[model samples]
Every structure is written in structure tokens, then in C-alpha cells.
Target: MQPASIDKQINNYLPQVTVNQKKAVLTVVKTFAEQDENEYSEEFKKELDSRYDEYINGGKLVSEQQAKKRIKKIINGKSK
Candidate 1:
């Protein structure tokens, strides 16, 4: 298998989450990390930044319940 595919398989075998969950996490993190602030329109940036408040407070990420809720909301197509 290709390196990328192999890495995906490994991620799928992660202890807790299923393959789809791992893939979704990878896709979101990769996409979000690659985004440029300028790519967002003013309104979208404002809203998203607000929603991310719990994910990042005091410039530190707290990836616990707050983060999980945000992820679920996004996955379910719910807007803030």
C-alpha cells in the first residue's frame, strides 16, 4: 500500500475510535490547519472564531468535552 494509505490503516486501528471517526478527525484537522485567516470572510471568521473559543481558551487548546461538542455540532451540520 502507499504510504498515505498505510498511515490511514494505522489510524483506523487506533484503540477507541472507528475508522470513520479517525478519518473525520484527520480530515478536519488537516483542513483547518491548512486554512489561511485571509481565506475566511469577515462574518464566517467571526462566527467560527467564537465557536472555537472553548477549543482554545487563553491561547491554549482544551480538547475535552468542549471540543467534543464542537466536533459533534459540526458533524451534524449545526451552526452556532
Candidate 2:
């Protein structure tokens, strides 16, 4: 098998719990570290950066009205 597939299998086999019911946070960290980093495309990166910038700089939250409007647009098939 390929290295990535092998590593994923190994990661999946790791123990998920310990003695005191503490969550396996290290497993999440390790999985993130071992993840295929290049799966994100340039466009996806640009969109992620834009959303992160908006959240950090504008501190914007999605309003119910905006969500309703988006839903309406989606239901009408008007959103591309």
C-alpha cells in the first residue's frame, strides 16, 4: 500500500481512550499533523483566508435574516 494509506490505517488503529475518561486530544493533533496538506486547492485556500480575515477583522456573524434570504435563494435555485 501507499505510504499515506498505510499511515492512515496506523492512525486509525491507535487507542482512542485512557483511564480517567479524558479525551484523546493528542490523537486529533497527530491526525492533523499527518494529514495530506496539499488536498486544498489555491481557490479553496483563498476562500478560507477571506473568511478568516472577515471573522478576525469584522467580527461578523451570520444573521437570521441573511440565512433566511440565502435559504430562499437556494430554494428558488437563484443562487449559483
Q: Which candidate has the top score in lDDT?
A: 1
**Candidate no. 2 TM-score:** 0.37
Mind giving the per-residue lDDT tens digits that candidate 2 earns over 1-80? 89999889756765565633334556675678777563787899999999999899987688999999988989889645
Note each model's CA RMSD in angstroms.
16.3, 8.8
Worst-scoring 10-residue span by lDDT in model 2: 15-24
lDDT of 1 by residue, 1-80 (tens): 79999889876677678779878989987888778533878899898988789556655665699999988989889653
| Candidate 1 displacement at residue 35 in angstroms | 0.7
Residue 7 lDDT, candidate 1, scale 0-100: 83
Which stretches of candidate 1 lie above 4 Å from their native place? 1-14, 36-80
Q: What's the lDDT for all of these models? A: 0.80, 0.76
Model 1, poorest ten-residue lDDT window?
54-63
